[model samples]
Target: MPEGPSKTAEYVATFRAVESARPEGERLFSDPYAASFLDGKLRLGAALARNGMGQRLVCRYIDRNWPGSRPSAVIRTRLIDDAVTAAIEGGAEQLAILGAGYDTRGLRLPAAREIPVFELDQPPTQERKKQRLRARDGDLPSNVTYVPFDLLDEGVGAPLERAGFRTGLKSVYIWEGVLSYLTPEAVDQTLAWITASGAPGSRLVYTYVDVALLKQGGEDEPPWSSQVAKVGEPFRYGLDPAKMDAFLGDRGLKPVWDQSTLEAIAQHAVPGGRNAPGFYRVAEAEVLPDR
Candidate 1:
């Protein structure tokens, strides 16, 4: 983990903040707590985004700097939000969010408020989020249990168990914007933990980049790659969307829903007016019963 909070997390929060600032009829989702996690110019920009004109200006500035990143993040957020809601409605008793930096789902989603939420991330980012939440809401939400641990050095099982995560419970895990930052070993370990620790019918909602993009071996890196690398959180893993079903099946998961970033944006965002990176994908999978 970086010495400070995750910059990418703050960037995603800024994306949600900007989206939430849109008029109620036009916004995809509302994350009222998202802006509180931002800093400096981003905080100012989110503040200004409360009006339609300000929203367009902030989006234009973000697009100029990050190309498809803002739209991709926004769309990804809404997709995951829908998946989580569906999971809750399907009887998920718990929610475990891996790399949960700056995410406000536990507080913002009413369905999430009905169950216990485990928010896991690096110590610095977890602390920063909690501090911001306390300042804004006077206390941490009673339903959220923050688990601060280094993803590189530790597996989630022990920490989560210590934090009162019950095994064999119907759970929903959100691995949003986190897989690309982990080593393959860490990723596999996490999957193993989720399958071993969660009961059948549990759900996992995650985002990953196309492995083909990572292995293409060209001078042209994806536009967002450089930015993450500059912040010391470079992408390290991706799954081929073509083989994702087989991959997850081998790991005891059944893929139920999958979509490319472009597809999600097209489905959820205003039509003919949005462009987002297509290499990023989101998937929802169900944990299979052990043989």
Candidate 2:
């Protein structure tokens, strides 16, 4: 946002991964290695918040202050994780994560362990992940490759190709928690590459804020936009819900799964959930095979 990898990206270190590291009853899932991405203070807080009200309190405060922040990220992470796992089981190969930031899926997911993991993000943030990863564990996974680049400045196809990404490989392209912060051109270019390069049956998963929420904002835009702006990251792009099916078709992709934060919570039986409309949406789209 301000410089390097987004300041907003750091929250993945705390909110999504770190908290998810708790025991199953406390967490929807766990990411033990995600603790490596967190700083000392975050580590301490997360440790104190490993279960019960302590954990709920942390998320409640964030949700109260910044609506849709915690629930969206948490549900989106779980959804992405499930999608990737299923794809791998179905014989997918290559894995690419755009704006990976502090995500630990490459390390933590069992299906991902044997596959080539290509992570793309800002140079500084990528380096920081490597440093923290090394400090936390000792060595990088042999299958993991880091591509240091900006999607706004450069298209993913070239850099990822240089990183040993093969064309027409059945792969999962993950652009988690990042689209709203990017320019429209960046979004289109990335999707173009994913749709064009993916082998038959490949798919992409990404999260986006609702366009209507930000467009006619009297209540939604003020707090959400300003809160993100305070961290030097502001919402720049969104997908229209009504046009999404056609939108995917235009890019040579087809919608496979779509979930709003409310739906995700309902699916997961998350308690005390608010049915907030115009919040966040996570969608998975399949790359239509070439005729």
Candidate 3:
């Protein structure tokens, strides 16, 4: 995608870097390694965000252009972090992150580090991620495995298995910030694959945009959509949050919880701050035992 690492992944990492730059008490999650994945203007922006004034300036610019992107990423990161930790405590034996671009969970989460963590993404992005990790930490964590494959070209099963992913173990899969760029068929295939490959109690956490917005945008595309399209990645799939239960159920998944960006912002963000767009959301579901 885009001839190299995904630009959107860097953007999400930049958001995390800026959030991590916040004072210890004010930050959602501490991802000290986020800044290591950024470069150029993104790198400078993250550096400037270390202080309150600069943080506001950087965040304001982002909010003005992308609305809820920064806060959504920040809040979703924490949400998924909690879900992953809970999964491990609930007996997850392995963690698989599909489309895992620049995500530092395996390295930052103590619970995740205790078990095998599979990071799967397109080859270019995965390679860049490895290079960045090696450069920043001198060596990648022994617990994390990187699997590279084209998301649009192939199913994740073979690549992941080749990378040491084992089925029949209760697992947690994180497919964050990736659904919108894939076709609906790909999305359905992935959900079904997870059910077929993970144990009965496995969990899958993912983020998606609302289908209404995707279908109703009509002639006027949203700024966020156009911005991402300009960089080669475009929004392609969405699901109605109201139908999440049925949507997951048909694929052998039981919905656990669905949280909108607005909900995440209200629950976790500082009050009177920029509001995250409600249409973007995160949801988690567990693999249903075969009937």
Top-TM-score structure, candidate number: 1
Residue 199 of model 1 has an lDDT of 89
Instruction: Tell me the tens digit of each residue's lDDT in model 2 across 24-46.
Output: 78566687776666666666656
lDDT ranking from best candidate downward: 1, 3, 2
Clashes of each: 0, 0, 0
Between candidates 1 and 2, the one scoring higher on TM-score is 1
Candidate 3: segments with Cα more than 4 A from true spot: 218-220, 271-273
lDDT score, candidate 1? 0.89
Query: Residue 257 of candidate 3: its Cα lDDT?
Result: 91
By the lDDT metric, which is better: model 1 or model 2? 1
* lDDT by residue (tens digit), candidate 1, 181-243: 998888988999999988899999999999876776457787688888889888878998889
Candidate 3 residue pairs in clash (backbone atoms < 3 Å):
none
> TM-score of every model?
0.97, 0.92, 0.96
lDDT of each: 0.89, 0.79, 0.88
After superposition on all CA atoms, how large is the RMSD of candidate 2?
2.0
